[model samples]
Target: MTTLVYLETHDGELTNGGLGLLSKAASLGGGDVAGVVLGSGVRDAAASAGAFGASTVYVVEDEALAAPLPQPRVDALEAVVKESGAENVFLPASVLAADVAAGLAARLDAGLNWDLTDLRLEDGELVGLRPALGDTVLVDVGWTSTPRLALVRSGTFDPVESGGTAEVKEVAASFQEFSTQARLVDHLQEESSGPSIEDADVIVAGGRGLGGPDGFSICEELAAALGGAVAATRAVVDAGWYPYAAQVGQTGKTVSPRLYIALGISGAIQHKVGMQGSGTIVAVNKDPNAPIFDFADLGVVGDLTQIAPKLTELLRARK
Candidate 1:
């Protein structure tokens, strides 16, 4: 089975999530794993794909594809799929990649399995593991036909560099008139301190138990002491206690940090499903019987208002 992993780049750097998916696909050892990159001036990022395990990298670089839009990428990816004759197409879940994957599925009339957390070769067939019943059960999903499309959940896999090289081939652009109609007007970036949750090794997340918007300062202080980032649950984001960009839950971004510090979080299923992949989970709550205590590697029964500041001070003193 020939696999094609969509490699998405931002600011000339390959996104870690896409690279992780590419690495996972290559690990299957089923057949040749190729990568498809589409963006203007992205030639430099193709080599990084090889380091993650792509045997070949197909690039479609053009001025029209420079913007982070979906239509142009969909057109470019469809062309590569046909040229490479890829039986399986995989993409890391992103706001833009999701649209591109959906467009490709419609263009090729292929089955699309989305929100997959894992994939494996079972009995010579590709099986995708997806969460069902509100993430209570893991269901095995498969495509009935060739040219299967899958959108893997973010932070599902870690990219392992093998120091390998890839054969880079530039594919010709085949853009339709309508595909290039939409153009990016302006991009507004959210201002935040410290590392982003996606890249942070440690994340300190707060929930409704934080009391109010001011309570986030406790999380921020702890995150700063740890040289990490601050995250929040959907409840706080919807309540305007935190920015949506920092929200961590089923409706928000998935993060797999080395250490996850949850303060005042009840560990509802929606929030647990997102951070369950963390290496070590530590929860600080006043309730000893909080649901988070059931899964957290370390549970501290206390009021975060008193505990968080002290923890931050201890970390600072150690430094």
Candidate 2:
């Protein structure tokens, strides 16, 4: 049985969350732990993937692979999937991964599982766990067909060192024109680089209940105090109160932090779907009826305007 994980990377750094998926997929089967990496940073990316248990790394290089649209990488991945005879495909529950997974599943005629909270192999059959109907219920997914595919949520599993060297092979191809409708007219990357939100030690998230843009100041204060990053809910981002990059929900980044502190967020399933797996979760909301309280390990009921500033001050004093 062979399972392949699409390794995610940016610039020259491999994604922190992708390593965890490699570790999880490796535990499920005993075939080649292959990785599909496309970009100029393939060598470093493949080396790091090896520490996470990858045995084979296929490098597909092309400028168009990073040519604004990711359809080329999806095509490259599909070609590799067919040639490698991969039985399973795993990817991080990220925007790019989600897009690539959708395309790959459609191209391969395989089932695509999204944002899996739990995964296991029972008697050579694969199954996944995820929230259903807006976090109101849990669903168990079983693939009845060949070459199973899943997008595992970040932070659900730990990445461990499993000493192995990945054999790097090159695939030459010009991937574009497949999805020609979407053109790459704009290109931008993050100016500041540090820890990714999903890999942070702490995350302080703000929401619309924060009242206004000023509400994020307190979140920043707390995050700075804790050496973490600031996150925001979909409501805040949709309303233009926060940047899209800061959004932490179904439409934003999927994060798994050591400690996630949510301020003024109502526990919408879309928001929780991406961030329910923190090591410790704390929430502050004015309404005790807020759904976020249900999954939070610690809850504080109060207006963030009054509560957040005080907490930030107290934390700073202690530090």
TM-score of each: 0.97, 0.87
* Candidate 2 ranges with C-alpha deviation above 4 Å: 174-183, 190-194
Clashing pairs in 1: none
Give the deviation of candidate 2 from the true structure as CA RMSD. 2.7
lDDT of 1 by residue, 1-319 (tens): 7899998897789998999999999999999999999988999998779998999999999998988899989889988999899999999999899999999999999999999999999988999999988888999999999899999998788899988999999999789999989989998988787899999999999999999999999999999999999999999999999998888877788899999999999999989988988999999999998999999999999999999999999999999
**What TM-score does candidate 1 reach?**
0.97
Across residues 96-209, which tens digit of lDDT does each residue of candidate 2 receive?
Answer: 778888988888899888878778877767889886776668899978676788987655667878988888778775455655456678777766344557668899999888
Q: Where is model 2 poorest over a 10-residue stretch in terms of lDDT?
A: 173-182
Candidate that would win on TM-score: 1
Q: Each model's C-alpha lDDT?
A: 0.93, 0.80
What is the lDDT, from 0 to 100, of the residue 147 in candidate 2?
79
- For residue 167, model 2's alpha carbon misses the true position, in angstroms, by 1.4
